[model samples]
Target: MALVAFSAVIPLMTVVNYSVQDIFGPGQRYFIGVDWFREALRDPEVHGAFLRQLAFSGIVLAIEIPLGVAVALLLPKAGWKSSLAIVILALPLLIPFNVVGTIWQVYARPEIGFLGRVLNDIGIDFNYTGDAVSAWATIVLMDVWHWTPLVALLAFAGLRSIPDAYYQAARIDGAGRLAVFRFIELPKMKSVLTIAVLLRFMDSFMIYTEPFVVTGGGPGSATTFLSIRLVNMAVGQFDLGPAAAFSLMYFLVILLISYVFYTILQRASAS
Candidate 1:
């Protein structure tokens, strides 16, 4: 715990220090004090990026949660095939983030890419580079493809942990499929699902690598998420002070939402 705290604190403290100080050079520094925070908060691009990030995360959860649960429900209870199924499902996740982006970037090229070629052959003019809608669809589809298995695996573990006695009781009560899911499977899966939701939210909210490599935040900033924007500010533009401040604020927002999710899930479970 002490080691973890020290590691986290050290970097955060360094960023905090940079957030206030203007570095003209190695020796030349000026204490600006919250100027970065003000500028970052007032930036319109920041606001647009944040809204885009929030909406994307929400949409992903809406799709992935139900889709994951459905996939989990379909898995066999016990067999060699179950293990095979799990390994196959998990294959997408084994790919590195940057590699996934590169794969998709090449795959989505309208002229040379296999996917784009098929779509064009089928009479659909699929051009992610020129179309904002196509770009958004590509990013969202890539994220869903990459991450839904994670949610499914977690949900499957939750389902496997559920006692057979619950299903026996449900059968005795003549419970319908929906009722069984609602009252038994879902309730049992609540803890794991909460964890899944929090994990997905945090990951999606901070998504940068895949989209960066695929879109380069192009099609006119359609896929420029918060993390991408922060990188552009801090690294691309070399605006450390505002970038640091924006990052801290971004971290706080994530922390607050995670806390709220935890509290609400706990309360729901308690009630």
Candidate 2:
């Protein structure tokens, strides 16, 4: 608890302090109440970034969850093959985020990268650096490639934990593959899926490094999510006061949504 307070709570309080105060330098500060918060709430850039962040998170969850579940279902149940499958699936999750970004950066360059060269050769004007649609698609693709493995692994665990007796009963009752999955498998994986959604949503919402390295929050702020916007404000603009306020609101939004998800999961588990 003490360590947590020192590591987490102390920095948080410092942010809270900066949020309400206008500080130009050491010994150059003044309390401004909620002025910065009010301005941030009205800021168009913040609103745009918030919407983009939501869209990214939504797209990720949509792509990852079902795909992961399907892959998990298809993975071998028991064998040397199952072990090989698990190892292969876990490879992407093992790569560091910055490294993933750098890899995509090189892999999408039109002059040299295989993907870029192939697309241009096929007469598709695919340039993530110069085009908004391409940027969004590449970022989404990169994120999906890297993180879907985590969902697969989680769903794999949930799938593996189901007792064989359930499948036996389903078979005896003439339950088809679809029926078994819909009624038996899905219900059993609900808790695991809920956790997966929460984790993915939170991670995707706060994603910065990958997109930053890939696009530098561009093709004209098209890929600038909340985290990028916050960094731009805090570091680039050097507006600590407004940046702190934005950070606080960001934290609150995350906390509120997390609580809502937890409550829903609890209610679901109960009945």
Candidate 3:
């Protein structure tokens, strides 16, 4: 346990150290204190990106959780077909992230892309490159297409773990499908659902590559989330001090939210 902790603690300590000091050149450095953190907190763009990230995360959770549960409930409970379904469901997750972005980028183009052509033909006027609504829709739908499988897989595992005795008892009590799901399946799946929610929240909050590749954070700055904005500041503008500070703050936000999620779930389960 000490060895495991040492491995984790060493890296985190390095980030915290960098977050406070200014690296000017090679060995030329100065302790600038919390100036970077202060600046990051004051940046209007940072505030915008943070709020945008929160909204995106909320949208993802809202769509993915219920959709995943429904998909899991619809899936067969047993047999070779169920095994095949599991394999098929996992195929999308196995693909690389950048590749997923590129696939969607082309797929949503109004000219040569299948999705685009269909939408245009149907008079929907969809174009991710030019339209903010389309850009947002594409991002959300891409996320759903890429990630809903993860939720479904987790929820399916949760459903399968439930004892047959519980179902039998529900049947004997004259409970219908909805009651069995609400009182039995949902309660049993709470722990796994919590895990899924946290995982999705963290991933969505930190997402950069897909949106960056697909939209380049625009036709304008419509899709620039905190991570993308941080990268732009650090690499694009060469503002290392502020970038380091922003990165540390970013880590803390994720850590705090994850802690809150764990605490709430634990209390709910205990009660």
TM-score of 3: 0.94
Q: Each candidate: what lDDT?
A: 0.93, 0.94, 0.92
TM-score of each: 0.95, 0.97, 0.94
Q: Best candidate per TM-score, number?
A: 2
Model 2, global lDDT:
0.94
**Candidate 3 — which pairs collide?**
none
Per-residue accuracy of model 2 over 50-122 as CA lDDT, tens digit each: 9999999999999999999999999999999999999999998989999999999989888888888898999
Model 3 regions lying over 4 Å from their true place: 1-14
Location of the lowest summed lDDT over 10 successive residues in candidate 1: 112-121
In candidate 1, position 210 carries an lDDT of: 97
lDDT of 1 by residue, 141-183 (tens): 8899999999999999999999899999999999999999999
User: Count of backbone clashes for each model?
Assistant: 0, 0, 0
Q: Which regions of candidate 1 are displaced past 4 Å?
A: 1-6, 269-271
| Tens digit per residue, CA lDDT, model 3, 124-227 | 98988999889989999999999999999999999999999999999999999999999999999999999999999999999999999899887687888999
